[model samples]
Target: MSESSGEKTEQPTQKKLDDARKKGQVAKSQDLVSAALLVGSMGIVFLLTGNFIGGQIVGLTQKSIQQAATFRGELDMATAGDVLLEGLTTLALTLAPLFLVVFILAALVGYIQVGALFSTEALKPDMNRLNPFTAFQQKFFKSRTYIEFAKTILKLVIATGIASYTILGSRHMLPSLARVSPAETSQFILAQIVELGLAVAICFVALGALDFFLQKFLHIQDLKMTKQEVKEEWKEQEGDPHIKAERRALHMELLNEASAQAVRESDVVLVNPTHVAVALRYDRKTMQAPQITAKGADLIAAQIRKVAQEAGVPIKRDVALARALYELEVNSEIPENLYEAIAIVLRWAYTVAETHPRS
Candidate 1:
């Protein structure tokens, strides 16, 4: 069956997964990144508020207000620009650390989830994305859309509950805030806000963890391959079955041709009458022992005998020795076990050649 015809049953291959990742199609939850940033920023603010960040914010606010109050009735362009620049610089300095912390936390969270990935494919404009039908399908028809909607509702409900609980828990301290100094009142309010923010952030992180797993599960489901797709991928890596069979046939044919030439050069052919044949070559000046030049079974054995006969190479029928040599690979030296048998055959062939001196 074709890939389109069958159900996707097999897990995605490593190559497919890698290709998807290259295109920035990874199982990463935006909610996870947001939650991490929110939690990190809230924690930093909670820790640094009174000691560092809070002082900077208060100073900048007071300076801006004082400058605004001191400005003349008709503000010149130069004075206006100076005020704007001073305010912006102070604000930037005050919030720079917070922004930096949030940025690092967001990047770390994204990296933990999807590793280092930068793909322009997602940024590139696509006509399909502009389609109203496609947008409608994504927004309303997909289960993912419903899941996102549910998650949004869940976040709102949890945040509201956390805020209500924080407010109620601090209810008794409300009257005490009015009795305290201005600085004490500001600190108390800041602490309460931080506490509420931390609670909400904790809830978001828990929800994000769950959502991350869900996204991963959905991604795997989407990447699943059909049986036919697996087969096609196998073919792509290992070649088509028919092509492989033809290559094997060609290899065997080449081996047979080389074996026929080896038989012609051999000094002796040991045969199992009709079943097996082994052609051996021996040169006292060159070879250490009798080497099997060619070996085959059945029809190939008959062909070896015919070639040996045409080349005037002697044929000796020895069932045990022939079977043994047949078991050995072509062009290999005779084994120690068959050395005695092969030596005897060589001796006999040499004797025959000496007695019949060919013209």
Candidate 2:
């Protein structure tokens, strides 16, 4: 038995999911994409800084400052514009690779989560969204809202702890930085930044994974169908069974009526003793071969025999021919393979007719 109207017991069908997707409803996590972008950007930064890229940036900075210093005495609109352009070009060169890496990673993460999807249905305005009461219920009354709140709090606490721990661990090394050479101090700072960034990225990824699963769970829950909805959908897809059964009953009634009429007009009735009966008719000027005028089994076979007897049609007991014709439809021509067998039955019927003519 199906569940009650209020109970959502059925999983969403493929058609249901496809319709939802067309309306821009899909399982995805913004947090996962954010995490991937952050991690990817940080990794790019770390790799660039560890290589000659970092030295190139330092050299560019020094050269810019030297140019600015040289222009101090003769600074003009033209000289300022040139200096600005040089600085902007250097900045673009420094950040372009990191930006590309982050963009690619974000796009890949989005694809993996939801595939390719574009729908304008989500952009359409709904008056329900303007209702304060409905908005309040969605935000506060929903269980998912509470789960999201808990996740936010947990992420804040974890991020704070990680940052605090990293700062405290580096506190001892901070004082020694002033005692070390300038190059050593710079390397130490860069190393600490990398360490902190890596730790934070790992935390984001862990939270993102949990959020992705939570999003999928909520998506499936939202798609569950009630019993009534399932029935309506099934009817739309496969048609109503009650209507189909009625049509079948009408078809059988018409077929039986036609068989009864054929039995009355048959030339000969062939019987499988008691189980089967077939009535055949042949007209030399009309029909090229003998055709079964009626066929039936069991109770219907009894009816065929009675109709044949009342019409004064000749009846012959031939089990093989009777069974074979019983398998054919009314008014169907007998197969060539059964020609000899049916010919024998016709001869016997003709002999009987001559011996006892009908009044």
Candidate 3:
């Protein structure tokens, strides 16, 4: 029956959706994350480290050239190592701003998509993933695999075209750069690179947004369940009807036992003569309002009255109040609208207690 999940004739139930979520399955796109990180970090890096990195590179290049010209110890292995180490350190420091911006952008994008979701279910070992047949099917047979392949090709083409167009636009500037100072050349290259990067990043963002919507639709379709699946899930969560019947019967039996004991402790029993009975309990020192300790009609009403009489608990006859109170649940506080009627009953019970106290 699990194989029939592929049919997906009906929309996914909330239970199925929630179960999938618990198992760390959710709609998300790697392309969208990539696009956001590329666009956001590129903009930030261009603003913060663009000039600094270009200047550093130019300075390092001039220093190296001057050192080579004055190379008294350039041939020594130790001296060569020291220069390489210094250049690497300088390069790393210069690129630190870009690395920081990319990291922050990635984290922010992840947060916006999932909002603190941390699941290890996906990381758990899966035998199916290791199987050659399964891998081949997923790679070549699935519709999603072909869609992804097409998207990747489209993106590559777009990026290549954008880069070529940007470079061609700067062809006239390239001839002038050859005759310019090293610092001026570095600045021109930096400007051109930033321009190309921003253009590509914007294009990727648009592609990513389109991919996200497409993926969302696919995810919904993939998760759809059949009518039989929905019915089985409902029974699993709510229990079979026969089982529910037994549960209800047991619950009522327990309530009957508890009500017997409660009627003995109740302050007063309100009765609709022979049809209804309602037991109320209250204490000035502990309770703010009278509480219905038990209520019933017909046979249950007769049993409640019998228990009340045997326990010496007071019985009051007020058909209107009994009928209203009978409608309330056992052990619930009396409503404010019934306070006036309840107070009168309590006063009467107090008088009876004084007149003929229970032993």
Candidate 4:
């Protein structure tokens, strides 16, 4: 039976929390590696597609210009629609392979983390999971909901503030750009792109900081354990107290039965007064040495002696040998040191049995 934890289980100490976090933080290395590879491959595909798109756009523009010059007029509207359709078709074609690769990569990541034991049980509809009360408790009572809400609000405020600041900073540029030449316009556009990128980088840093804190919080929360829970788990794993006692009782009963069976068949039942008893048997073809068919103590010892007398099996009084046999041997063979003594006892018993043959 398992030992119980005290009535009040204290929350995990800092040390315990650290240990739990260490155990839980066994990151899936293969999944992460595969994810990196997948992202790199997808990035390459997108880069190639972007180049193709740029070339197609540049080529189309040049062709339109040539057509306009040849016709001695502006390009026809119908041809523009054809150009748009061709660009869209090319975009779709470029994206198809990338999408397929992404889908397979995501599946690989999941497989690496959890293996291929896909359970339809998880997919089956659960009414309890969708219940309003369950949802409310999960969202409010659970710490996860609070953390998610805080992160969402933080992201919104930071992103909006940065975007507003950047837009305000660019107000004068817009009016100036409206009055600029093509060369000046290109310079202004380049400056705007740099400004926008810096603002995005600041927002990204804030997001990363939030992610680190959120993960730490979740790790700590999961490590917290109640005493009652530990005790219950221990009992379930090691066995219930009552169940263990019952099993021990049954085991002793079986041992007694085995002892009785051994006594009836044994050539000799050796006893050390009331404390220990060992029944031994020797069959020339079946065993090279005497085998301890069964052994017992106290009341079981008395039973073994009684059964031996009823079966006409010989009984020998060897206190030291009996104790040694009972202590050393289990359900099998006699000790090697006791072989000479056991052989002498067996020879005497067989001689007596042969002299007084069974009626």
Candidate 5:
């Protein structure tokens, strides 16, 4: 069956996954980034700027009041402009650290989830997104819409539970707030606010992790292929001409090496004097007949002759014996029909080996 017509039963191929990634299709949960940013920004505010912000606000209030008090009349445009510029400048300077925290945390969270991915494919406009029918089906007819709804419910329940518990714990301090000094009251309120923020942030992290895993699972499922697709991909890869050529070259190289080694180990190389060469080895202790260790023609025969000369193995020129032995494969024993002829050649080689006895 065609891949598109069949059910997706095979896991996704690496090529398919890589193509999806290049098109900016990835499993990502925005909730995870949001949760991390919320936690980071909250920590920066409470730890570094909790008192600094209040002090800056009070200073800006004093500056505005002084500007009005000095000119004791309806505010002139120039004076108001000066005060406004100062307020804006103060606000920017005061929140610079908070903005930096958010920027850094968001980038870090996104990188941890997707590594280093920069694709503009997602930014390209598509006409399919404009189709109302498609949009409607995606919103109301897809499983993802229900999944989002479930996530929302989970967040709401966790947040409400945290809020309720926090309120009950701080109930006894509510009435005493009026009697306490303003500074102490502010401190108490700040502590309660910090507690709530921390609890909410922690819950968000838990929910975000669950959401991330769910999205990753769905993404893989969506990319799964059918069996036909796997077969087609395999065929295309195996049939590539370049790959086949490489395989052939490697096979030839291995064969040439084996042929050269056999020539060096042969008991004697029987040659046709110029063109054909056949190397034979026999062990009366182990073999009943002589074995053809190597054979070659033309350039390879020259190579085998060269290896035989270097290894001190004797070379004999015999047209009939070399021609007949060359027809057999290397490593095969000579047929019984040729044993008498081979025995004469081997007997002469042994006599030469014993007489010339080189160290």
Candidate 6:
């Protein structure tokens, strides 16, 4: 039974594809490194900006506290609310533009690493992807995903623990902070900021490194090709051997058919038996010399002669001319060197055939 249209056809396997799957194409490590640098730079900018903003806020709050104690004026809650509102409004106006600039810079830096081409094909839903078995196979069965999940958990635990430690450590310094002079307090805050920043930076750097490796592993896994897909690609690119042989055979058959047609329509067949055959046609008004219509050897030569006999076309038995024409003038004008000789033979034959007028 013939295969249905929708059924998949088998094709030749390519070793190149197998090799590619085993050693997947390498991702640009430079891009990932650039991305990491951009992320770390953004973190540094956020840390510096946040610290500066917090220091300004604390200074304003402290001034308000001092004014409340020293001034003999009535404690107006409405005035306090107005001052607080103005402070918040000023902060919002100043920091909104700064945050916008930082965000745009960070986005541009990330784009420089990953490029700007947004591939929406990756977002398209696939029925195969929704299968529970396939999902399970990818998440748990795949070593890459299993490792990524573990790394993610480790990163979360480490970052949270480090951040918690920094906050707790700040509490230890807070009690003595009230007793110190303003200059000393400021110096101690600066020291604490540096310590916390260093801790956060170190923790995130380790997590980023793990994320980078996990990303690389996932990319390589995704690029892997199945055996069947590799075979189909080979068939599409480099044709199947069996199909190629069949096409070659069909091409030869068509050539034979064309040769047969030329033979049957020819005016005369000149032959050196199986070795040579040349079919010639001449029209006195249309052509200055006889044109060779077809030529071939062995079985084809015999077929040409047989067709010429059935069509009542002349058969000249000149071994030298037949062999020469077959070798040099197959489907072309007869050579200038042999034209005079051929004219003489044709004139003589015409005379003989005209006088006899065979019944």
Query: What lDDT score belongs to each candidate, Candidate 1 first?
Result: 0.84, 0.83, 0.82, 0.65, 0.84, 0.64
Which should have the higher TM-score, number 3 or number 6? 3
Superposition error at 54 for model 1 (Å): 1.9
Model 2 lDDT per residue over 1-359, tens place:
54743788888988799999999899998889988987987787687677577877788889988988986688999988988898889878877877887899999999999999999997999998999999999999999889878888987898889889999998988888878899898788778778888898889998898889889889999999988887789677646687567545644663557876777677799998787988999877999899988777755677778777877789999887788788888778989998898888888878877887765
Model 2, position 355: C-alpha lDDT score: 86
Off by over 4 Å in 1: 1-5, 65-75, 181-183, 240-359
Predicted structure 4, TM vs. truth: 0.40
Which parts of model 2 are misplaced by more than 4 Å? 1-5, 181-183, 239-359
Q: Residue 238 of model 1: what lDDT?
A: 60
Candidate 5: tens digits of C-alpha lDDT, residues 1-359: 55568989788988889999999888898889989987986686575436677788778878888877988787889878988998889878877877887899889988988899999998999988999999999899988899999988988898899989999999998999999898788778777777887899988998888889988998899899889888888688669897678655644763657876776777899999877989999988998889998887765677678878887788899999899999998889999999899889989888888887634
Off by over 4 Å in 3: 1-6, 44-49, 57-71, 74-87, 172-178, 240-359
How many angstroms is residue 237 displaced in model 4 relative to the true structure, after the best TM-score fit? 2.7
Candidate 6 residue runs with Cα over 4 Å from true position: 1-86, 101-109, 122-138, 156-175, 181-194, 206-210, 238-359
Residue 51's lDDT in candidate 5: 67
lDDT of 6 by residue, 36-69 (tens): 5545555544554465765665666687778677
The regions of model 5 sitting more than 4 angstroms off are 1-5, 47-49, 181-186, 239-359
Root-mean-square deviation of Cα positions for candidate 1 versus the true structure, in angstroms? 14.4
Q: Report the C-alpha lDDT of model 3 over 219-269, residue by residue, as the tens digit.
A: 888898877777788678566687667555644774557878888888899
Point out the worst 10-residue segment of candidate 6 by lDDT.
1-10
Better of 4 and 5 by lDDT: 5
* Lowest summed lDDT window (length 10), candidate 4: 26-35
